[model samples]
Target: MSLPLIGTLKLRGRLTLYVTLLAVAPLIISTWVGANTTRQMMQDQVHEMLRIEAEGLKDLVEASLVERETSVRSWAEDSLVREALLTGSYEQSDAVLSRLQLRYTTFTGLVLFTESGRAVSASTPALRDSFLGQDEAVRNAPWFKAAQEGHFTSATLTQEDPVFGMQVLHLAAPVMESRGGRRLGVLLAAYDWGQVGEVVKAALERARSRKNESFALEVRTASGTLLFDSRGQDAWHVPNAVAAEAINGPEIADVGDGWRFVALSDPEEVYATVNKLRAGTLVGVLAVVVLAALAAFLLARGITLPIARLNRVVRRIVQEGDLTQKLEVRSKDEVGELAESFIQMVDNLRETTESLQRGTRVLTETVAELTRAAEQQESNITRQAAALQQTQVTAQEIKQTSMVAAERAGAVLQVASRAEELGRGGALALTESMSGIQTLRDQVDEMADQIGRLNERAQRIGGITQTVKGLADRSNMLALNAAIEAVRSGEHGKGFAIVAKEIRTLANQSIQSTAQVGDLLEDITQAILKTVELSEQGQVRMEAGLAQARTSGDSMRALSTIVQDNMNAVRQIANAVSQQNAGIAEIFNAMTDLSTMMHDTMVGLQASQRVTEALREVATQMQQVARSYRV
Candidate 1:
């Protein structure tokens, strides 16, 4: 799911996020660790400081108690107080106690208690009358009891005195003689709680002055009773008004006798410094992150901008169908190299396209030439077919004429036979027969002349057919050239190549047809030569028959022989004419074969024409396709 979401983000957004992560990850971790370490150091320092302050306050309390006890002991051993106490003179002791109390202002009042629990002397008249130590109770009193052990001592704590109406501490010392060491009495000195409170406040003030303003202090008894608090608020809990708070138990030092000096320092003092450090570190980290992000943004832009440009160039090429577009190279980096490569590719494409267009033009021109040639060949074939048709009709006419001439020759022979039988009977009959023979000779001469002219026309047609064959060969060469050009055009030339192939096939067929026509023409020429020879022979026979008829007018026997010779020449003429007719029949068959070949040639020409037209259409289409692209 996260993968898809990340994929959908834009490159810049993702890059920026990644850059920020890369830049800030270490910063965040280091900041967290540093804050922890700093807080710990501050806490350690606070604990150490609190511990030192509490120990100092404890020492101060001990020193105050020791000073008071020493003063009381000195006063108890005074010579005047000792003698007075030994003699049980309260008045004399009162004078000494009054003077001693005057010298030590911390002493609230001084009293003398004997071993029997009697108040022997008192500095304060009210304490003398209201003394709780009346008899056995005085012996059991803590101060008197401690003094009775024959040692110097003092009360460990200051407490409230109901008779004095004040808080006071009592100090007791024994009064005894030096030599005999006889016990005299107990001397008790009272120190006010206000004096102890003042000493504790002064000691704590000194500690407070050593720390910053947020530092606070508290003193408590061993039983967790609050003795003094710097903030005048709960020593165990923070006040609502304070920005920073303290926890209970703090750091404590024992003053002595179950008394405690509890010190508390507000956390704001440490947190203030820590907070400043944290703020500075955050600013530094943010600066680094901002700089890193800017660098990443610039870097991302540098890379992606060029890629976008290249993409646009490619799109333009595709949309416009132009291959000549080139990319600009501004740097010697990978993107620059890519642009260079793209330019090279487009150049190559342009060159290939130009080559193809050139080949197409060549092929189109070649096909056009082939088309023109095919059309000309078609025209020639049509003309040749028409001529052959005419020739066929002329041959039929000549055959009929030859048959008529043969019948006339036979009639002339019958006339010559009658002339031979009537050779002694008359000149007039012979002259008439000779005239008919002369006319027969003239008709044969005319037929021979017509045959000679027909042979000449046939020879002319053969020459024309040779020219057509030459044109067919030329057209075949053109088709082959077209095919070669089509091959050079690659895929675009496939259609053209097919058309060229068809044209070449038709050209081949035409060549074959032309060859067949040439062969037929050769046969017709031979037949015409044979017919000319037969005509020459029949012409000679006609002249001989004409001479024989003229001779019959002069001599009967000579005429009869000449008539028989003429008859034989006429028979020979008839035989030659029959052979000539048979040659003409062969010539007619050759002409028919020639006509069929011409028809096929005509069909082939028509096919070539159609193929050429199709090729032209293909070239047109190719040009249209090529035009869609720029060079």
Candidate 2:
């Protein structure tokens, strides 16, 4: 299926492309921002955890020191150390020192200082078990001074032993007696600092979860000496490098070795929790995306499918030439109306085409019938002209015969008049026949009547000739006009050109055919002039033929007078000759006039035939022009 269009769009398959972007873009932005916030929050949480851990360690360490100090104070109040203190006996003090050492193995030493600031019994294993009488710790140290003021004392942790080299967490307390006795001395205990190192190591172990992490717990004397490091690295050794307040404990003052420390922590639980949260969110996001896509597909289909169908209808219009393949009237939407309008237009066009076809057919048939009639008319004209030609020929023959008869009669009558001069008995009888010549005058009057009617027919023929000449000229003009129209039509008039040529041919025939008519007219006029000339000739011939008649009449009269002279045969012969001669003269005059009239008629018919031919040519040319546009 081809994609649908929406204002030149080609990808109508997914309307939700923008919708998905709109939904997802902000979602992704929020996710990114949330992830960054989570990371910062995790860092802060770690920092908070570290601070709480350090504080907890400080409280635990302080609690452990207080317990140890209370235990040491109990030892200082012991019957053994007090008895030894009262007697001031070295052997008994040695016994007390041995007991103290045996009872508190956690301590480095237990020393009892007297009121005079001497160590009476010391857990130091060599030489006199005593602080010297002038020992500064016994006399003025905080633990010793507190003991003298009747307070139990706690000692600061020392990196080295009091009299040796081992480091210890020191604890000390005062000895007091009842029964009006006041404070006697201070008993101090030194613990191995190794225990503090062990506690720190344990806490470090507790803190560290993932690999490659360690912890530290450091302490120092007021004079900045190497005290302790839980992590036990050389970080404690750099003087002036460690930042102040790293440990944030009273014991941290004068710490020598370490500043910044890394606490190793296991990440298994943290990563597992992070993984759960991340996986759940990823699954939820994927679910949402899939749901959104499904919804998007459904939403897109509702719009795209209809559009696609509309597109197919439009394609049919373009490709198949099917204007009828319009969208159905599914709704009152714009596309539906547009399709309906298109169909209406197509229907109107089809009807118009049908009407045009019918009208053109009727016109074509009518024009064709008219053209055929013109052709038939041309045929009839040809036949008529041919028939008229025969008439003209007959007319010519009659005129020729009349001229010969009239010429011969003149010669014969002259001979007869000359014979009258030899007037003897027969001659005188022949001359006496002239007195009856007046009887021949009646025959002359009858011939003149026929001549007058022939002249009238000639006049009628002349009128017809003029009408034919006018028709031929009109026809020629029509042909020229058709040719001009053909030229004006350009290439579309090629068929018209052929028709024009045919019209010109027929028109050319008009000129040629009309020449025959003009010839006939000239012949008619010549014959008219001939008739006038022949009238005079006929008058002379009439005088001769009449003279012969007169001579014959005289001969008849002479014969009547000479009936007694020769009643046997000559008079009867003369009467028979006179009757035959008068009949011949009348027949000859009628033939001559009729021939002249027929010649004139032939001339007029020829002109008419030429005009008919020219008209037929013009119609033929029109027919050809019409045929050129047959398609």
Candidate 3:
């Protein structure tokens, strides 16, 4: 939920509310925070204490169990007990067990069993008879079975003995023969479960002693079977008390053989200190809020009362039309400064009002003087109006003549522009021709270089053709010599001569082909030389043409420039004539406007005479208004 908008409240109400909230909000928040913090701290302390108590109680139970087990093991190892087990005589063993049970009062009963699972003796006759009658039950018992397997074990569940009607925890230890480690029998001891309960009860008492708070202690088996509760309930039940009203502890500790120790406390008793602190803080915060509200109300009254008085005075001055009223400064505070400033403003207003009364009288006399002067100006302007009309007609004629001259000059400028454009177009064509000639010259030069390289290649080809022809000639000579040698050898020479003749034919064909290649190479070389010479000539001619075209382009550009200059001269002449014409037109318009203004002045003079009369009346009313204020 949101608070009301403070702007709607009066200053006093707003101040009271603001102060109350300022004082109470922090106090309430702090009280709530402190209360929660104290409550949590108390809960933590209680939980820690319960944990310690559970741990202490668990240790006590474990120690008691250990003591009982030790006592049973010692007695089981006694020579009399060992001999009785060996000889199947248990009278002395029964006496030894009875003495051990008496010495260790925590043990409710002690029983000794044979290796064959027969009860030989016990601390009490009832225990011995009950166990001996249930021989099969003894052998099947968990404690008995564990002892027979040579382990020291404790029964996790507690039971009420049928004969003694007491809760008992069974502990078993294996008895061994002295030599060769033979199993003799099992010693089973029943520890008093009440002793474990007493340990928890004692811890609860110690906790209660430290603080007068109700506390509970519980001992349970690992399966959640309640062995003992301080409240004396037989069956386990959930402690369903309200969380704020009770502190339920499951501060658990393992009390050997799977038993748990738990503790709980009453919430009301544990949180007493925190409750008191919260109550005190709330009371203090309420008192502070009341004080802050009271102070705020008084302060708001003090400040607003002065402003209210100033407001009343201002209203009276406005209603009565009085500038001479003054405010008195009662204190040297901001309110006092406001009062002093108000008084000064009133005095200044009074002086300004008196000055306005005097100024209004002067203004009335000035209006009369202005009225006479306007009439005199109207007459003089009427005579000047006639002279300006005649001069306007003469200026109009001159403007028309200048406009015609400007039009003629504009037409001449157009012709000159056309001539300049034609000259520029010619110049552009010449420039393009020059560029084309230059490009052609460069291409011709490149072609000449290509032709020269072609001639060199063709010349090399001719030399290679010559070398091939010489090789063909040498082969022909060799073939002819071989043919002659073959002819000198008869039939052997006939085959050799035929081969030589074939070789000579091939050589001759090679010679003819080489000659053809040489002729083609010579033709290509001549053509290349002719091409190079023509390219050189073309390049020289192109360079000359390029120079001539460049010269022509320059001349054309210069002629274009001259024509452009002539066009600019004509444009200047046209612009000057137009400017002169515009000047004359402006003069004619000024003369016409002057004549119209003269006529308007006559009408304005008459209107001014009437305005002067109205101003005089207005000044008289202003003087009356100023006089009304009591300054």
Error of 2 at 522 (Å): 99
- Candidate 1 stretches greater than 4 Å from native: 1-10, 25-48, 132-144, 149-159, 176-184, 200-236, 239-259, 280-284, 287-291, 309-331, 338-631
Error of 2 at 123 (Å): 1.6
Query: Which order, best to worst by TM-score?
Result: 3, 1, 2
True-vs-predicted CA distance for residue 401, candidate 3, Å = 14
C-alpha local distance difference test of each model: 0.74, 0.59, 0.77
TM-score of each: 0.44, 0.36, 0.54
Cα lDDT tens digits for candidate 1, 323-400: 766677888899789888888888887887787788779879999899888878778778878989999899888878
Model 2 C-alpha lDDT per residue in residues 107-163, reported as the tens digit of each score: 666666777677666765452343564576557776567666655433444435556
| Residue pairs with backbone atoms closer than 3 Å in model 3 (clashes) | none
Q: Cα deviation of 147 in candidate 3 (Å)?
A: 3.3
How far residue 145's Cα lies from its native spot in candidate 3, in Å, is: 4.3
Mind sharing the TM-score for model 2? 0.36
* Backbone clashes, candidate 1: 0
